[model samples]
Target: MQNMSLRLRGLWADRSGLAAVEFAMIFPIMVAMYFGVVEYSSAISVDRKATQVARTLADLTSQSQTIADADLMSFGQAAKAIMTPYPGQPLVSYVTQVYIDSSTGAARVQWSKELVIDGAGNVTISGTAPHTQGTTVTLPSTLSVAKGTFVVWSEISYKYTPAVGYLVSKTGMTFRDVAYTRPRLVLCVTYPTAGFSNCATPL
Candidate 1:
């Protein structure tokens, strides 16, 4: 009976399977942390890309000699240029819904759209003003061309894929960094040389 008891004790003291137990205990935590880092990194990248896209759109619209209908097409093409690396399809789709705030009182072209999927995996868009429910966007208002320069509002969004899908899945875990820039020409104006009577119209 004593020999049997000694054998049971030796069996209980054996270290076999210890490493597997430790690995099992630590593996999930390590995986969670890894995914967290990836999510954070993706978020940072998206933020930087969002800024680039906004600046590109703003620069293109502002530097152009004119912001007319034909020129707007160029603006779309310009958007495609700025949003590199990421597929242009989503961004291009959002561009169609841009709106330039031409309200008589306000000198601004308000353009806005969503680029990423919500927590629910739904495509969404937002704007300074209401917009049509579609991919690309545009807004129209009375152009007070003479009084003040027009404000150009450009917005873009994109959803990130889960590089580490094993850990977490939620909406707020992802975000879109929307950006805004006023046209550089906002302070300038184009009008007739002689106020009114002599020229076509006052600036």
Candidate 2:
């Protein structure tokens, strides 16, 4: 009985198990923190990609003077090409709003669209409408368009999904990006014409 009692006391007094117990307690927290970091970086990457796609589309529009009505379809295709690797099904959609100055007869255009990111990585295009309000949404009539001319505003949208789903909230996990660009120059060219060739000619 005495030997058993001594053994029990020794076991109760030993400090060897403290380190293992502490590590077990903190391991989950460390893992969670690591995952949080991954999630943050993933979000940042997606944002940059979204921005790049928008900028690329805008630049493409600005560089051309022979943009025809049908070229809008090409723009949508290019937007989708740029926004790859996202987990959600990705899509490209655009809206075009035209504004004309009553006094100067100059024209201005603006665009705004939603880029929806789904749970899996796939892309599609939707949304082509006019804006009815706000200041920034409206551009100057004399910014570049010719007098009494119509301005075309296009809004492009793409859907993106995060890589680290476990880190971010499952609800509203997708992302959206929109971009707009007005015609820099007006060329008297119609669709399916050689205008694109001349417009695309390097300056």
Q: Who wins the TM-score comparison? A: 2
Model 1 RMSD in Å is 9.3
Candidate 1 C-alpha error for residue 51, in Å: 2.8
- C-alpha lDDT (0 to 100) for residue 35 of candidate 2: 83
**Which regions of candidate 1 deviate over 4 angstroms?**
67-78, 92-147, 167-178, 185-203
Best by lDDT: 2
What's the TM-score of each model vs. the native? 0.54, 0.58
State the TM-score for model 1: 0.54
lDDT of each: 0.46, 0.51
What is the Å distance of residue 6 in model 2 from its true position?
8.3
**What digit string (tens of lDDT, one per residue) describes model 1 on residues 58-159?**
566555433443445455555555555544444422332122323443233223223333343333333322333222332344333333333445556555
